[model samples]
Target: MSYPNPNPYGPPPGQQPGYGYPQQQPPSPYGAYPGGGMMPGAPAPYPTVMPGGVKAARVMLFVLAGLNLIGLIFAVMGLGSVSKASKNASEYTTSDAMTAMNVGKGLLIAVIVVIVLFIGAAIMLGAQFGNGGSGVRVGTIIFGVANTLVSLLSFPFGLVHTVLGILIIVFVSKDDGTAWFNRPRY
Candidate 1:
């Protein structure tokens, strides 16, 4: 009779080598990515961490929201004043006074609506920075453009908004910001 193989690592005679060892898979034809499992020539994966510029943009968004809140408060106060002025104007029979009052009230209401929208957008976009996708990037750019334009109307106080909006646009439009927003979630 034949004796068993002397080497413990080797398979016994008449038995397959896989009996006690794992089988090796054939090498893939394509080269592996640096992280492995990825196909060759694919774009590099985005970074997992939030980039500095993106973080700064997010912070600026929140700040812009805060400023918008202040504007909302002022607009509301102005609306109240307009209502009072309109009431006093109603005492006069002249259509001119009434027309002016109505116009002032309408303008104040419009300003309030716009301020509310700006505040909502700033908070929503700022909060989404952690998990937001490319849409967030696009939304931010649009928001920046709008903010800059709106700030032009207010001049002195809006100067702050204009500066912040410009900075946010710059930060979010950079390469690192794009990568952060494009990064795969999960």
Candidate 2:
């Protein structure tokens, strides 16, 4: 038969919960204590951190720029075609082409203006990637909304731009994007 321990109320001898023995600590109320552990609602401490999905936003801007470039090219080609046709019609037919020519000129100016505005906005949006302030984010969102609405005016021709603009708005407004913009810096 084995003998009973002298102190029954506590752990026996070296088996006590201290020194070399392991002991379970109570759950911390404040969460992670130190090191690289992340606390809930705490921003990441890494310097290379960026907003989520910013790449896609930048890509959208680049796509918009490409579309604007395409529009410029198309506008140039259409202008050339219209100019040649109008000149030929005026030379071949006695009917007055002045009104038609004036209308075509007006359309050309309008197309050029729209294309320039979009191209400029696209470049600005792309340039601000990873380096812009809160103002840039707000401005981009506004630009995207305005672009989408105006693009809708172009209907079938602008459907792609409208979709891209919508995507930009969504991506920029995401939690990661906001965190990146609002993250503290040195």
Candidate 3:
């Protein structure tokens, strides 16, 4: 079932070097061949090869981070919507209306605050990974979260603001030839 190498580059004695064949290495402490700590016939730890490609993993992380940011923005906007709905129901300022409006406003404000904090975190991470310290990632997150929340609760114009923030983060993050923090362009 096995054939001879017929050459030095070919398979070794009693073993082939191709598919399903085992590779040979030097021996050392801890074991016979040091590969598995067993005898000279032990096998190597399956190869410490990387699971997924680095580039692909990095890209996926960047994307998930971005999507999470967007989700945070949407959550904040939901708060404002609750507020507006409450306000509308209180046009006559009745006791029930007033209570509803207050609850809505409180929920809306709280959500907005939480969204702002999340956006801030994203901006910090983005800046750390992307452009230098001068990056407007933080500012963009703030403006985007705020504008989107307000727009959702008040008007439709806030969409533009949210989009702008996303654009800034994505574009700046993609820029190359810049320092890690705010150092030189190296």
Highest lDDT against the true fold, candidate: 1
Model 1 per-residue lDDT at 34:
56
Shift in Å, residue 1, candidate 3? 70
Q: Which predicted model would earn the best TM-score?
A: 1
The digit string of per-residue lDDT tens for model 3 on 49-119 reads 22233223234335434665686677667766766676577356688777766876677577667556655
Per-residue alpha-carbon lDDT of model 2 for 1-186, expressed as tens digits?
666878876577657456563566754544566763556776454336565577888888988999889889989888888777776674556445766775886798788888888899889877887777677778788878988998998989899989989998998888777766666666
The TM-scores, one per candidate, come to 0.75, 0.70, 0.32
How many pairs of residues in model 2 come into backbone collision? 0
Q: How far does residue 83 in candidate 2 sit from its true spot (Å)?
A: 2.3
Q: Sorted on TM-score, highest at the top, how do the candidates line up?
A: 1, 2, 3
Clashing pairs for model 1 are: none
Give the per-residue lDDT of model 1 (tens digit) for 88-145: 6645458887888789889999999998999999999999999999999999999999
Ranking by lDDT: 1, 2, 3
How well does candidate 2 score on lDDT at residue 92? 57
Model 3: CA > 4 A from native: 1-61, 90-97, 129-186
Error of 2 at 90 (Å): 2.7
